[model samples]
Target: MNNQASRSPVFKAMLETEMEESLSDTIKLSDVSHGALCAFVDFLYTAEAPLDDDMACDLLVLANKYEINHLKNYGENFLISKLNWESSLKNYSFAHQHNAKTLLDDALSLILDTMDNLNEREEYLELVEKDPRLVVNIYEAYYSKTGRCCRCHQS
Candidate 1:
């Protein structure tokens, strides 16, 4: 593959390097699933890939890892389009982990909008246990959005 076809710096660097994969006829991505690899390759060639709810996150991850800006944006937009209250927390966490700022903001907005019932949800409790900082971030976001501190209503 030539540099003109792909916008990914990772691919450009790999192709330019004297690395074994560059010299060899094959390049193996052990962590990527066959379907994801196929889709990633297809995107590199065509600048497009069919994305479903299940595939979007995976593609986003691959896009991020490979530093494919357009593909990453595509996946982030797809995930944002699919966002809902039920999946907001999970998506928010995924976005944070993946450094998808737009997706993170969108998911955080949904979570904040539903904050009245957030504590009652099992996911909220799980997040509290698994990543308390995320829950703190939610509260901080809430305060930032509302312009009110959590301590203001104290008795």
Candidate 2:
């Protein structure tokens, strides 16, 4: 892709720096899904993508990787709209992984709102086993909202 066609700062910078020498002119995005890369390129060209829940998650990762703030925000909003009890923990983890603070906080809030039954879910158990730190963070957030420290229970 030409530098002008790349709206992403990361991609644009890479193209500018790497294309200067031009022994080979290819950007390898091995980690990004085919669908996400395609949608990202389409968005860079036309400012649009056929976003859905699955695509939004994939696109968010691509957006974050490329430092494309507009597409990142779009992906965050789409994920927020899809959030619910069933998707909270997964979204929370995904948001954290992608450095999407807004989505992470929103998902955490929903998890706290339903904290009474959160542990009953299979996902919760799986999360606790896979990443105990995240479960601890959830409790920390819950206690903070109630005006107490999780460690000492002080106001």
Candidate 3:
């Protein structure tokens, strides 16, 4: 994850070192927790992750905010399955800011499916980083299915 942190856009993370001062006995960990990051990597590799609701929600927000589509999809799907609702607007804001369209779509889809839109959702169409290839693909597939040839209407 340290290696990944170096590779990804620096603006993507809220990385901070907060320490808990120990007054009495405390067992120290030999290594930092790899749980979320490892799960994220697994999601990247296989499009599958074994995450509980809370963990999946947390990581999905991070992944979406970080513009990590693969991880976001996997985490969102996991959360959808578990029906996690603690996922917040912070996730949506980051996703919108970073221009991760597919992830935002998946997240909104999950929200619709779970019937949990506790936070306000405004028109996110202002998130304007549309992928041309995705648009073309959707047009081709959808227009062809409807026998309309969407490209012809673009003139």
Candidate 4:
């Protein structure tokens, strides 16, 4: 377990440092769910996990946190494969939060493609309320792509 887990830069650093966790037999991760933890450990050992949408999201977070590039890429690819109009906004938000560049780009493309109905979605409203900067980024992407202003729709 130590050998496999050390493949992550986070675990490697933790184990190498003279910190309490380095001397301890058990380490605690409070933020992640039990299932995600298990899957993350399993992936460390086996290089794969049974990825669903929720698991992909969880693993993506974990992988990013731990600097596990392979696992992060795996999770991103899974989510990207499942991208759609209904889930694009939510996925975009998640991708943005996690700094998943490919997933963010893919989700943003979908959101841009469906901008006409963007205001109808509850997620869009929530995102506007919660992270309005992200919404502005959407408009910026639109303007950049189309060479037209978001409000006036003129180049």
Where does candidate 1 clash, by residue pair?
Answer: none
TM-scores for all candidates?
0.91, 0.88, 0.34, 0.94
The lDDT values for all models are 0.86, 0.86, 0.48, 0.91
Worst-scoring 10-residue span by lDDT in model 2: 18-27
Q: Cα lDDT for residue 7, model 2?
A: 70
Residue 11 C-alpha lDDT in model 4: 78
Candidate 2 deviant stretches above 4 angstroms: 3-6, 18-23, 149-155
- Tens-digit per-residue lDDT, 1-155, candidate 4: 57865678887777778977688945678899999989988898889999999999999999999899999999999999999999999999999999899999999999999989999999999999999999999999989899997788899
Candidate 1 structure quality by residue, lDDT tens digits, 47-100: 788999767888899889989889899999999988999999999999999999
Any idea what lDDT model 4 has?
Answer: 0.91
Highest lDDT: which candidate? 4
lDDT score, candidate 1: 0.86
lDDT of 3 at 95: 44
Give the least accurate 10-residue stretch of model 3, judged by summed lDDT.
21-30
- What TM-score would you give candidate 1 relative to the actual structure? 0.91
Cα lDDT tens digits, model 3, 1-155, are 44444333532233322333122222232332468757666655566777786567666666655666666676655544543334422344444555545544555444444333332333222222344343244345445545664657532
Better of 2 and 4 by lDDT: 4
Estimate, for each residue in 72-149, the C-alpha lDDT of model 2 and write its tens digit.
Answer: 998999999999999999999889889999999999999999999997999999999988999999998899888887
